[model samples]
Target: MRLADVVLPDSAVCSAAVDVAETYASPALLNHSFRSYTWAAAYGTAQGLAFDPELLFVAALLHDIGLVAEFDSHTVPFEVAGGSVAWVFAAGAGWSRDRRRRVSEVVVRHMGTEVDPAQDPEGFLLARATGVDITGRNVDDFPAGFRAEVLQRYPRLGLVEEFVRCFEDQAKRKPDSSAAAAIGNDLAARMARNPLERPE
Candidate 1:
């Protein structure tokens, strides 16, 4: 997939997601978000899957918005918080109620252990793409050339360290949050072994 061939939607909903995500997130998170969308879209294209590109784009871009200070939630997990933010953003962009709900569903489900593609097309692809970006899982699922194209356009930018740090902060702030659990559980080890991890 050539970077030039990728087409992001021009709607206000999509545009707002891109702008808010980029503005709120750090360089690492922003790059990861973009890569997530690219990988998911590329995978959809490869699999002959039909999806709402605009919906997927907004979901992917805002998936991690909760990690940023402005959107952090005090009680619920970051995923839910992020989902709510996306939902509201979509509504403000004039998305239909169903479409906005889909955005929330995708954002919330992206962090789940698995997302059934039949049940949630956007969520399924988002999780798969996130796995590749964050953990190097299933890197070979996409064509090497396609992956190369995406990485070239949006490099890792030290994502592992940055994400780990962000998760650590989330853990400290909300000891019972899912982010905290991930940290306690093999987060450090997983990050250490991440194929995407770059040497300092």
Candidate 2:
């Protein structure tokens, strides 16, 4: 399925998620959040995966929220803090406790190495989509025309620089966090060479 064929969910919670993302996220990050959903939705549709659009949309919009200064955690990892933020947002949205927990789990899982789609399709989709957006992994999975469409709708701005800087700050503050581990693994260098930024 093509990204253009997917309809963005417009539930009340979905609207609130966009507002929150725009309020706290940088221009680059805000667009990243929107693009992430588009990527995941398109991927899921193409794979014939069964997933909840609302849940995935909310999770994608708020997944990197902890990277923002407004919500950055001093002790826990950014993804951990972001998960809490999602939990609170879900609570305020009147989602059931289980669904709230699911959102939180999805946020944290987005940072993990891998997730099985059968167990958690939203988490799997979010992880893959974020990888594509941030690291340009699996870019060829989407047709070139569709990738251009997504980039046109939600421009990258300076997401690579801005996101790497955020993770650097997070690593310094939370040495044991995932950001720290990623730094040690040369995440910045890899992201610098991302194909999305130097497409030929």
Candidate 3:
């Protein structure tokens, strides 16, 4: 689906989320976050699943906020740190307690291997989209033309190399965190072969 055709919620909450994420994350990281949202939205549409656009948008944009140095919690996994930040953002926007909790859950669980959409649709889609963007996993489910369309709107801008560096930095700082565990299992080889890191 085209970025324009994709309907995002328009409100103070959504706008504030964009502002906060853009302020904290690097440009490459911001673009990745936006792409993750679009990919997840597309997947939801294809699967005939209903999702809360506002929550999904907020969760996706801020999923990696903890990777930003200012938000990092030295002892926690980056996802947990990011989730904490998201909870505050959502709460400040007057989200109900349950809504804010879902926001936190979605951000914290995005790195999981599998999540049931029926139970946690936001987390499930966020993980799936992030996986597709970061590792090119399940990318074939999206038509080549549409994938190109999305990329044109939000280019990777060397996101693969940038994100790998961010993950590596986090892992080194918190060796027992999930980021450290993903290094050899989920990230290492894919980052080495990532197309975004290829010479132009």
Residue 11, candidate 3: C-alpha displacement in angstroms: 1.7
Per-residue error (Å), model 1, residue 99: 1.4
Candidate 2: worst 10 consecutive residues by lDDT? 191-200
Instruction: Compose the digit string of candidate 3's lDDT tens values, residues 150-184.
Output: 88888888786788788888889899887887785
TM-score list, all predictions: 0.91, 0.97, 0.94
| Prediction 1 TM-score vs. true | 0.91
Query: Residue by residue across 43-149, what tens digits does model 1's lDDT show?
Result: 88878878889899999999999888898987888999999999899889888999889999999998888888888888999989888788777777766676777
Which ranges in model 3 have alpha carbons more than 4 Å from their true place? 192-200
Which is better, 1 or 3, measured by lDDT? 3
Best by TM-score: 2
Of the pair 2 and 3, which is ahead by TM-score? 2
lDDT of each: 0.84, 0.91, 0.86
Worst window of 10 by summed lDDT in candidate 1: 191-200
lDDT sort, best first? 2, 3, 1
